[model samples]
Every structure is written in structure tokens, then in C-alpha cells.
Target: MGSGSFSISGSGSGSGSSLVLDGERGELVRAPAVRIGKKGGGKGGLLDEKAMIALRNHSEAERRRRERINSHLSVLRGMISGTDKLDKAALLAEVINHVKLLKTTATEHAKGYTIPSDTDEVTILCEPQPANTTNTSFLIRASICCDDSPELYPELKQSLQNLHARVVRAEISSLSGRVKIVFFIIPERGEGNGEMGRKILVDSVQHALRLALERVNSSMEFIPRDSLLNKRRRVSHFESSSSSS
Candidate 1:
């Protein structure tokens, strides 16, 4: 019949064309006729077995990497919270301390108390008066035990200027071994009145003081070599001047 080769077995129904089976070899003896409607049935067309396995492995690796990054962020959060640095707790404490220091100093002033004269140490001195003045203000006297150098004066001035407070006046006193800075903070009128104005003034001054200290401490932590050299030069100049005198 057909030109294509076919097999005829012993029990062939008709000798036209017949297919044989090979059970032992697990292979088809004759090619099966292609169905006209069948189009895209294939093993290597879409994604093969190896490709699927690779896709699954890549997805799992990405998931694990994201999990690790999240874990690190959590640890940093815990550390910041525990240390109270740059967090809500530190801010609240700063506000509370400001209020307390102001109240104590005011009370002492109202009672005609004399502030202890220990300029070499850190202290808060207050002088209160009746509400007859034009403006409510805080006269802050800050003293610190640091080197006495002309170069430091400008740095100290710059730091105070950065406070953004309404400064009435600033006085710097360079003693034998330390420097003293005094700031008179006058709260602008219409900000508040009566007790509220006093509170606002006190809070503002305290906040400024805190900022100044933070800056000073930061500067002290990493003093530039050039600044240190200038300081030494000043010290030598001072010594020479004293010896000549």
C-alpha cells in the first residue's frame, strides 16, 4: 500500500500496513500518524525541568536576602531606643530639666537668696524682679573649665550665634585658666504674657544652652589639628607675655 514502510505480524488483520510493539525495548516500532488538529505539544518548547528548578532557587535566595536586611534594621532601632539618643525620651528629659532649673532659680531669687560664687564650677544663678519691666528675659551665666585662647573666643561666639535666640547681650570673661560666657535672653513681646511668658523664656534659654553644650562637646571630641596648633601657639604667646611683664 502506502510507500512508507510498515510491519506485518503473524496475526495481521490485513497486509496493507500494521504497527508492531516492542515491550522489552520500551520504544515504538512504527511512527504514529500526526493528528491534524494537534499543534503545540512539546517537552522543550516552554520551560524545561532545569529552568523551573533554577527559577525556584532564585526566588528563595531573594526572599532570604530581604529577611536579613530587615533583621539588621530592627537591631539598629533597638540600640537607638535603648540609648535614648536622638529619641523622644531624650527630648522630654531635656524639657523637664529646663523647667525644673528655671523654677528653682526663680524661687531662690524671689526669696532674696545669694547665688553661690563658684565660677570655676557649673552653676545656674537667677535674679527675679516684679513684672514691671518692658520685657521678660533670662540672664544666663555660663562658665566652663577650658583653655584660655584668643582663637577659642570666635568659636564660642559662633556657637552662641547658631543658637538662634534673641540675645540682649553677651559678655565673655577670660580668667586665668577658664572662660565664662553670659547671655541675656529677652523673649520677644507678644510671644506670651504673665507666667506663660516667663515659662517660654526659661524654656527657650534652656534649649539654647543644651544646643550649645552639644556643639561644644562635639567640638571637643574631634578638635582639628589646626585648631589645636593655634591653641598651643596662643599658650606660648601668653607665657611669653607674662614672663616679659
Candidate 2:
């Protein structure tokens, strides 16, 4: 027999174990210890040439398995509160209990959840808008909320174009499956008293938003400069007649 080193067994706990990885005899030999011994010799009855090789292989495999299991247990101990004193088996049980409790709580909350109606979920309002320092124009604001759709912006632009409205400012936001758009637009220039003009501007915003809601996947409206000017003149004539009445 040649002379070399061997694994020494320590305290029964797994953590205290080092290299002696024998498992067939149901022994909890601890920490690995390097010892000066005959190269072909081993303690714990693993002496037969074939027997020693088999035991050594089996122990090494067992050690790797324990390492993996302990690694998972260590992660669980870190995540869960008060697991410092727990044994491996107890730690696993605690994790199972914790998961079950979380599932139960989530189930209870889902049972009580209420779905909102269309009216409850959305608000659309239109109003007159004050002029800004950079531009002097009759403006109106339209606020709309609807389900998120890729065609929202195109449809909104199409609707405004139908009424000859000029968009001065626009903001879009999305949250909780809904999209809200706030637009400040200048209605087509028209003949009217100040209050009459304001009313018409507000009406134009409302009409544009109504059209946007009604027309989905519609082509964008494109009005030429000359046509837009003529449309404004028509609006002015209509407002002038209404004011004179």
C-alpha cells in the first residue's frame, strides 16, 4: 500500500464535515480532514478495492447533492424572517407555510375586487381656453379618456381637422389601461361677438372629440391651406348670422 492523505471525519452535523463522503452505512461523519495515511486505506469499512472506489464515488455525489440542497435552504433562510435557528427540514416547512399564506391573502383580495363601469372609469370635458403670450387666437380645451388604442392620436387629429381646428397644445397620458388626452385648439377664425365666438369654439372642441370617439381606424383628414381659409370664412358667416339674429 502506498502512503498519502485521507479524509478525516468530525462532528455529526453536515457543516462540520469536510471530505469523508461515505453514505451507504447511514453515518453522519462531519468536516473533511486531511490525514497522513496509507494511500489505499480508509476508515469506516470502505477497505475492499472495489468497495472503496464505489463508496468514494457515492460519497462525492452525496456531498454535491447536499451542497445544492443547502444552497437553496440558505437562500430561503435569508429571505424569511426568524430562520436563523431552523433546521433544514423545518426551514423547508416554514417556506411552504409562508407561500401558502401569501396565496390565501391574494385570493381574498381578488374576491373583493370590483370592476368599474365605463361611466365610472372615464371623464370627458370641454371648456374655453385662455390665450397664451406667444399666440393670440380663440382657443378651447377638450379632455378625453378612453381605452388605450394605437389609433387614438390619428383619430383625434382627423376629428380636429374636420372642424378646421388648429391644435396649439396637446398632451397624452396612459395609466391603468386607459388613455387621457388634453388638447388646446384654436377654432377656425370666424365673425362673431366675443361670447358667441367662445361658445362656438367650445362647441367645436366637443364636436371634434365626439367624432374622434365615433371614427376608429379612419384615414387622417388633410385640408389644404386655401380650403381651410374658405372653411373659416363659412364659419364666420354662420356666426355673424347667428349673432345678428
Candidate 3:
């Protein structure tokens, strides 16, 4: 059957009108309008004009809040590696994983284990392995106190490689003119026996550290103590301002 002409009609409905769905006629018909407000002959109704305005303002505020949350979530989604998928669940999972990794990194650096205060010297500690322990790998911890430099870490890594040792794991931390590097290493197989391996590792690491220190000392410009303190103060001030903003 062809649809008949249906018109939606209402007047002074205020905020308390019930909508009737006429399924047979396929039309929405509103109930009789009930006037509510100062002129409605009642003291006050729950759905007064003032209440409707308040409700509208609340709805608009909530919509803006949701839009802000969605914008932040979209930025996070774009940061994930596989953003082409366009799946909310996948993006959330990636964000969660990335957060876990950051937490782990923070915990690992919570304490300065290798570097000590009042020590402006390069120190290396190689733990002696007990005969009973079956693990053939060696652990070497190195701490260097020097000014911040970009090439220091790579130079140290190259030194380890020159000794024919492979780094299994490394933890590196740097702060305020101090750097600490710890390495879990294993000698290249067939290079030398156990005793020879230890000797080679010690010699190579010490020589490399001395050479690195000499290079740093020669190239570094000596700054006055007062100047260093002023530089640190400026850096701290900048950090505080940035964090506050």
C-alpha cells in the first residue's frame, strides 16, 4: 500500500512530551502538549524551560569531553606501528605493550649501580667466576665519569667487538656527566681457552678504556666550577618550566 501523508505536529511541549509510535500507520504521533513554567499556571515543574537549558548545556559539555578523549586516542593510534589496520582493539593492545616496555626500562634505571659519587675515574669490575658454576659467559661492569659526549657509547661498543667478544646483554645509563655500561659477554668460540679468554678480555677492555679516556681528556675544554654550576642551574630551570607548562 502507498504511504499516506503524515505530519508531525506539536505546540508548547516544553520538555515533557511523550512520543507515540503508531506501528500500523508507520508514524510517530506526539501526545497532548503540557505547558510547564511560570506561565503554565504551576509553581514549577521538573521539565521546566530552565531545566531543559541546563540539560542542553550538560549534553554539550559531555560531547566536547568525548571529542577530546577521541582526539587523544586517535593520536595514540597513529603512534602505533601497524596503524593501517584501523582497529581500536589492536591499537589499544599496542599502546599497552609499549607502556609495559617503558615501565621495564624505568625500573632498570631506578638505581645507579655501577657509577659512584666523587669518583671521576674509569672503573671496570669483572667478577670472578667460581669453578662450580657451569655458565661459561663472563660479566663485566664498566663505569666512566666524563662530560656528556655523543661518540662515547659507540666507541666503547667498538672496543668490545675488537676483542672478539659478543655482547649478550647490555645496560647503559647516563646522567649529569656520568655514564655506566654493564655487559654480559661470551668469548667467540674457538678463539681461546678459558684462562686465555679472561686475559684477553681484561687487556682489551682496559686498553680501550684508557685510549677513550685520553681522547676525551685531550678534546674536552676545562670549564670553571662556577660556570658548570651555572650551566646546571639553567638546565634545571628550563626543565622545571617545561614540566610546569
Q: Estimate each model's TM-score.
A: 0.33, 0.35, 0.39
143 Cα displacement, candidate 2 (Å): 1.0
lDDT of each: 0.46, 0.54, 0.56
User: Order of candidates by lDDT, top first?
Assistant: 3, 2, 1
Question: What lDDT score is found at residue 162 in candidate 3?
Answer: 78
- Give Cα distance to truth, residue 91, candidate 3, Å: 58
Ranked candidates (TM-score, high to low) = 3, 2, 1
Question: After superposition, which runs of candidate 2 have C-alpha atoms over 4 Å from their true positions?
Answer: 1-138, 188-193, 217-245
lDDT of 1 by residue, 25-60 (tens): 444354232222215545442333344355445546
For model 3, how does the per-residue alpha-carbon lDDT over 84-191 read when each residue is reduced to its tens digit? 565767778889989999999977896555442445566667665566642444555555666545556567656666775555555554555555555555555554
Candidate 2, residues 150-236: lDDT per residue as tens digits? 566678767767765566665555544455566665544553237776666567667668667656423214323343223211101
lDDT of 1 at 127: 52
Q: Candidate 1: deviation at residue 97, Å?
A: 42
Question: Which of the numbered candidates is closest to the native, going by highest lDDT?
Answer: 3
Q: Look at candidate 2 and give me any clashing residue pairs.
A: 16-31, 17-30, 17-31, 17-32, 18-31, 18-32, 19-32, 191-236
Residue 82's lDDT in candidate 1:
42
Q: For each of the candidates, give the backbone clash count.
A: 0, 8, 0
Worst 10 residues of 1 by lDDT: 236-245
